[model samples]
Target: MPDTSRTQLKQILATRYAYLVRRLERITGSKEGATDALHETWLRLDKANVSTQVANADAYILGMASNVAIDQHRHERRHAHDDDVDVLLGVPDELADPERILTARRKIDSLKDVLRGLTPRRRAILLAARVDGQLNREIAERFGISLRLVESELSAAMKYCLQRMQEAGDPYTDSRSSGPRKF
Candidate 1:
């Protein structure tokens, strides 16, 4: 790629970094998987042939990230580490020990408790904005509420959840803040 094109690509990448990561997470179903996919996409972008004037750098990166995610998924499926016997028996080759499972269950229960503690509308808004990837305007329209209300509820819900997570010793807590970050 030409120097100007590379610079442009870098700018696009910087601006769309969070959005791309969220998209990869939605596709791959895990933060680690998303990170791996992003790294692969970056590598591909660095080596991409751009001999012609490109249209829409954001779309190009999104397409590349999607392709990388698909390739990663295929590779994982083909080289699955689980033993053939395990697969035939419909069992995992290895499972977390009972203690780990119990701990995870406890953490999930704590998270649920925190969520249930929120007002119903706030909880719904949080789920819509975070889990369903709905914009504030979309959520406001869907709920027949004002955009400012949607934004306020979402912010409050996030802060409450982060506080709860911090109280529960969640590793996601940010050092600079009193609680976990807004995802």
Candidate 2:
């Protein structure tokens, strides 16, 4: 609970409720958990005996939501079900085959090697775009390069990775040959 009046908390929650839910979802890894945490947050805020005026209502509410999420995580950890025992009790295992797992590891290793072989700038651009989920424009701004250059580097890196994957006999490769296919 934050040191804010209930009225202010309610107002902040009303306006930015959706955003808070999305943030909580990112923290909790599921919509249901986020919803539950939000509900708990509302309840806690309603019962909080705070009289001090809050300078920033949004920050206060976000803090409360974060606390609720942490509590929910702790509760879940306490009651976590053992997967091994559950599997013995007729829970269907959608586990991957050992051969498939081995193939995946090999492909991952090959991709890592290919990425390692790239120029530093190209590798950084590709990682910023793909792994960090940065937009090309953002990468361009961050790297102090033109957007076109960023796109070119990213594309070249992707092509190299795809070519290496094809050479490694990647099952997901559309064309059977390692060479470029006629689209």
Q: Which candidate should be chosen as best, given TM-score against the real structure?
A: 2
- Candidate 2, residue 41: CA error in Å? 1.2
Off by over 4 Å in 2: 1-4, 82-158, 167-169, 174-183
Per-residue CA lDDT of model 2 for 124-161, tens digit only, reads 99898779988888899999999879878877988888
Residue pairs with clashing backbones, model 2:
none
- Provide the global lDDT of candidate 2 against the true structure: 0.80
RMSD for each model, in Å, please? Answer: 9.0, 7.7
TM-score of each: 0.44, 0.55
Q: Show the colliding residue pairs in model 1.
A: none
